[model samples]
Target: MASKMASCIFCKIIKGDIPCFKLYESDKTLAFLDINPLSRGHALVIPKFHGEKLADIPDDNLSEILPVVKKLVAATGATEYNILQNNGRGAHQEVDHVHFHMIPKPNAEEGLGIRWPQQKTDMDKIKALYEEIKARM
Candidate 1:
């Protein structure tokens, strides 16, 4: 974890090694403006702990993320926004550290643009998958 933290850019930012336009900070989390923003008030909320994905982080470390994001949205006066968290490279997670993007959608051309590629639904398969996941949970 220490080695990973040493290599992580977010970790460096948290440690003051790299400068950032910081917005909020708590014992467990940090919020800052995105250098390459999708919109005027695009920001990122990240857990202080070094975790590559959501599941890797402890619940306590994750507690401050949403509240910070909410505060950022309110502070920025963003009525429409997307709170996004990606897990793996295949899911469009560029950085390995677990961070949530608070992208304010001020217009159609701005913020996080996405396309939902809907798949054909099969009730039988869906039901089986649900049952399997529910049982595991």
Candidate 2:
């Protein structure tokens, strides 16, 4: 984990090794403007702890993330936005760090465009899967 943190860009930012357009910072989290933004006021929120995925982060470290994102939204005056978090390379997560994107959607052409491929649902399968997951939870 120490070695990974040393190489991680976000960790570098957190450690003050890399400069960022920092917006907010707390003991548990940090918020800053995205260098390569999808839209104006596009920003990122990250846990201070070095975790590659959401499930890897402690709940205490995650507590301030959403509130900080919310503050950024208000501060940026963004009326429409998408809060995005990807888990792995397969999920389009380029950085191997647990971070959330607050992408402002100014219009139809910009910011976190995605396709929702709706699949036909089988009720029995859905019920069975839900029951299985619920039991685990």
Most accurate candidate by lDDT: 2
Give the number of the best model, judged by TM-score. Answer: 2
Ten consecutive residues with minimal summed lDDT in candidate 2? Answer: 106-115
lDDT of 1: 0.94
Candidate 2: give the clashing pairs.
none
Task: Write candidate 1's Cα lDDT for 13-62 as tens digits.
Answer: 99999999999988889999999999999999999888999999999899
What's the lDDT for all of these models? 0.94, 0.95
Off by over 4 Å in 1: none
* TM-scores, one per candidate: 0.97, 0.98
